[model samples]
Target: MDPVGYSHDEKGVSKEPQHVISEGDHGADTELRRLLSTRHLTMIALGSSIGMGLWLGSGESLSSGGPAGIFIGYVLAGSMIWSVSHSIGEMAVMYPLPSAFVQWTGKFVDPSAAFALGWAYWFSYCITIANELQGIVTVLSFWTDKVPVAAWITIFLVVIVLINVCAVSVFGEVEVIASSIKFGWIFVVIISMIVISAGGAPNHEAVGFRYWNSSPFTHGFKGFLNVLPTCIFAMSGSENSGLVAAETANPRKSVPRAIGSIWLRLSLFYLLGSLMVTINVSPYNPDIFGGSGTNASPFVIAYREAGLQPLAHIMNAVIFISVLSTGSISGYGGSRTTMGLAHLGMAPRQFARADKTGRPWLGLLVTLVLGGGLAYLNVNNSASNVFTWFSNLTSLFTLFGWGMICFSHIRMRYTWKLQGRDVAELPWKSWTYPYAAWWGLIWCMVLMVVEFYLAVWPLGKPSSAKTFFANYVSVIAILVLYFGARLYYRGPWWVDASTIDLDAHRRFYADKDPEAKKTGFKAKTSKTLGFIFN
Candidate 1:
């Protein structure tokens, strides 16, 4: 009997047993279903990422980095994300598990690292849920100070929880609708900025490159570096697509397509959006630092300055929707990640339980409790203070998660070669390869350190001890979790390269007809649209 291969049973058993992790092995009775399509996966990434970070946080980045600095910061951050996404995409297509990186780290790196990364990643997403909930109230306050912040937070908390408890298909449908609105809103804003820059608005001021020339780099290089954290937060959700790979149908096809489209999305939505904001709004606007509300949004400021009060109000409404969409996505991701930890035996078995609808109800309940409680902080703390604390905390954990992904991928590649596996057999392969993985790992670590420094010693002035602690607390927490898990597990510092199992749990399906071809304009047009959109 082979230890790693299937063998016949004694009682005249026939056919090979599936070479994948079974629910019983993990002490669970059910598993998540593959119901998400390509469109759902794509929109999950877009909807999760294009939230308060861009709609609200960009103003802070622009104020610090200036127009050119902000643009450059996003480009640099986008490149780093590209590297991270490609690395994870390769492994995800092969494994296709929820919170796949956690399992990948356990297999290819070290079990301790996996435990730490899983919990840290879960914490990041949980905080993100809270942060987006806070964003709801902040954005709504633009229209009315009538409602208390706590009331709005409670309202959104219930809404997000309800969305997560439903079937994943329902969640996907909501995301598709919300993401479409977000995309359309961005398109309108970008076009409006172009028109305003061309002196088409009532202002009739040709603002072409005017802000850039006046203040290309605010506060100098330090300022440029300052905005990187904000940009990272904005780009954090790029990995949500890969996280959903396990639940996505045809992951081999859909996952890669979704990951590949990230570069385009970042360019079109983030870089272009930043460019438009820089052209239409000045960094010196008092509202640029409007302290955690819709008015702080550069888009809103630009529209109002152009005397388009109605348009500004509409943009505010769109932002509120975006925040809600992102909050819901965060809850979904966080719940799944918690379940993945349980699947790996790092958490209680109940956490791994799924309802008939394939919803991780226990995980969802836990995430809701934590996130909702955190959202209440917004009621007492200043919005800006709450936002900064949550943003900084999430950014640290996110960077750490990216580092683990890159490191795990590098180890996986080495083991793949050791096992004599053909590269061509991989469902997806990262084009940048060894270089990209190394680049991503190094940069993510560097940014993590820089963020810690910035937290302690902010650019302009000395931060209070409480503020500094809030900013750097994530770093300490992760370190403690890693070492604590190591002590308990007592696993090897690193897994042996030759012992890595690349074939376990790989989804096997019948081969498709490679020679089949499509013809006609409708087919060709459909293919073209899929290429562009996916």
Candidate 2:
């Protein structure tokens, strides 16, 4: 390694840091300042997590599991996500980087895990971005059905790409704007739903929790379990906030606060949002779902029930912003993940190149353009099939990433004890370890098993068709391609710690704030207060 610590590009590419092609070679890629604040991080986390899913799919989940069932499902999954967020928060503070999980998986687990998780996550976000851009055309169809989805999709692709390509702060600003619109729509819908349900409307009497109590299907443990995946998916933005960890000035502070915001997102946004949807309209009605149109969102349906004209138009606008913010973040995520993979020798090295704004320009644009193409192609036919494939596969890889995070924490905890370290030294400790991680794994495993069964038999009935794969033949195809590449490359299943880079990290991330020049402010403050009291 050179004295400055940056490894030279193998192909003798640009000597510039931004153009560095390899990782495990410590270096800086851009002159971009770390500018994101706690507030930005928090909103970014919420914005990325709150997707079109809540607006689009909650009705189906509610239908499967009644009001109580839906609530229980979200509460349960949100609780687990909270635990995972904290676990991630604790580690993130110690090692903030754009390749957040990639570093951890490589350093703590193995290079292979990092590579696999990074690529899988990258693909997932790519799919999500594609889906989001595709949605814009569908939403705009409310105004003029004559316009082609492809044309609008191309237009939006350019707009979002320009915003992202400008600068990190610019991207952050645009995301916040989009997020505000999303939040505003959800809040208004929720409040309006409450007003309508409380004997405020002529046809509707005070429902007063009647919708939660009544459902076509039996509501109980069975129902709650059924809606669990949807709930988890709604709160799915757990990994995004940390995507900026490396780019922020004080990730140590911003990331934890962003992590804290998960609770707020779940409690205030998701919970209230679901409650509003359930109360305004009953989930059991066939009118709510199983519809002829792509406008199957529960929020829009409730707004219609409350006598809102141009119901599709209103919700469509809200969803448009939601899709934009989410897809932008997803593109960011895919680029960073690619950079991480390139660093780990899992992918070719050009992806590590960054622009003057510290953004992975080529990487982000590639994912965006590719995702846009896939989404626009689906304009001829409904893209539900593509959406489903991306969602399930992405969730699968995410579950794997979660497992690695928990396991890495477990090892860190042990290493600390062995080195005579104290738990108090950590900036944040996981709410409950081993237990939380184990139970999460168990829960995910159960869900995976059920999904497999549902995929094979479908709704509990046996199917003998060899072609039937729950219509997930596409996912299988991707998996085969991925594993087949692994076989072809003879990729190592395990990584050696010695082969990994373990340099002293930036102080902000490792929680050894150089500016403070003091350790344990909380501890010091407590001791001084105790002395005074004594």
Candidate 3:
């Protein structure tokens, strides 16, 4: 087989001139189309992060850690997410592909790490798919309790599956619209919060830092540390932009922009929103801990407390839309991760198959079955317990994924130096470099340790050993997969820096290639916005 030419398909037929499957060449011939635009990419990243977690789950964080604690936790977590995004963005733009960082782990570090991270990430998304589906039921119950939870879950599962099985363009467009709605709604809510805080509501009572001073820390520093898991879960999907890089148009330009905007989005929607919640809704408010469902959302509680019952209902509806958008994006992420795994020969070849529209039907179908089953299981459990279980399962996997991205970036830069590759040749680079990557890696490890401690010895609460294992099971499972891959594959513990393939499968365009030139106001505007945002 030619290293840079056509390779045999599963049928042993040389169908097309595809780059050989090697370091950077994994999934080079994937049928997934590059139909997503800059807007789609940006919205997907933004929409994925601003979901039910922000709307409803923040209540849990606020309840666990008081206003000051929650704010501090998000600031710390936001910085770590930013570092991870930069590290992943630099590599995704350089070699844009599905599950870019996962493949990079294999190329720059070790196949075992890639295998572990890929499966860990896939599992995380699948769990999120179920969590979001269950979330729909919880959100709907806010308006009425007439519908059975099982029916709601089934309906949502079908709708999400349909979206994932459609053309990639349809998914991109849906995400664009959904994400835009979420972005606009957040600003509206933030402004409303500001009004409420400043005595603009019917009650006309100013709530300036009252909650912060009265209950700055719940259960002291331990309570503040306890909320870290919820905060981490809220920020989990911010990196989905990199997963879409393979299917994004002008990814070298678009991906970096999408990744760069993460901090801004996090600050506006998460950090500032937390401030708004703390100001408008007291930590001691019973509604802040309204068990499960959308009723517990700080946005809803704050509005209702301000004597605006109608606005609370409206916010509850918006939470439903937010969760639906999240479910759709989770489906997309899970299917793509599955396809990436299959592309690397870790999963069955059929799992990598796609239809005419470049939709990964087989992988999507498999994910739907698993995710739907989990959602169905939740139908029998209390919504609060279901949310807690899923959240616990998902919390650690993201930290592990971020750790891998930072580690991989460190190794990639080392290899680039060893190969004498010019940094100027890179499309995007992380300004923070060694420090940013190291900071992300070390803190992620610290958070994981803290998470384990909270699981066993929760502050001001009691938990059993069984509960502890359940919470940390994903971590244990990934460890098993990592060592299992290492033993089975018996590849080098780490690839040599000089032997790393940095150039293969790069999406290069000639000066005369039709896409190389920009025309029209829309194109130029898009480019400018991407540059500014990224």
Best by lDDT: 1
Model 3, 377-407: lDDT tens digits are 7767776667777787787998998998899
Candidate 1, after superposition: displacement of residue 145 in Å? 0.8
What RMSD does model 2 have? 6.7
Q: Report the backbone clash tally of model 1.
A: 0
Candidate 2: where are CA atoms >4 Å away? 1-33, 202-204, 216-226, 284-290, 310-315, 383-386, 460-534
- Model 1 stretches astray by more than 4 angstroms: 1-18, 21-30, 289-295, 463-465, 513-526, 529-534
Residue 109's lDDT within candidate 2 is 61
Query: How much is the lDDT of residue 94 in candidate 2?
Result: 64
Instruction: Return model 1's CA RMSD, one decimal.
Output: 4.6
Candidate 3 Cα RMSD (Å): 4.6
The CA lDDT at 248 in model 1 is 74
TM-score of 3: 0.91
lDDT of 2 by residue, 1-534 (tens): 111223445753212122321222222233334666665776787778677556655766677677877777777777667767776777776666567777666656644455566776777677677767765665565467787777888888887778777778888778777776776676677667777789675456677678765563445555555465556556666677666766666656577667766777787677888888777767765654323454456676665666665654677677777877777787778887777666555666677777655777667877887777777665776644444444555555565666667666665566666666688877566667767766665665566665555456543246655424533443464466456555643435553333333333423233354434545887678545532221
Q: How many clashes does the backbone of model 2 have?
A: 0
Q: What is the TM-score of each candidate against the true structure?
A: 0.92, 0.81, 0.91
Q: Which predicted model would earn the best TM-score?
A: 1
TM-score, cand. 2 vs. native: 0.81
Better of 2 and 3 by TM-score: 3
List runs of model 3 lying over 4 Å from the truth: 1-27, 289-295, 509-534
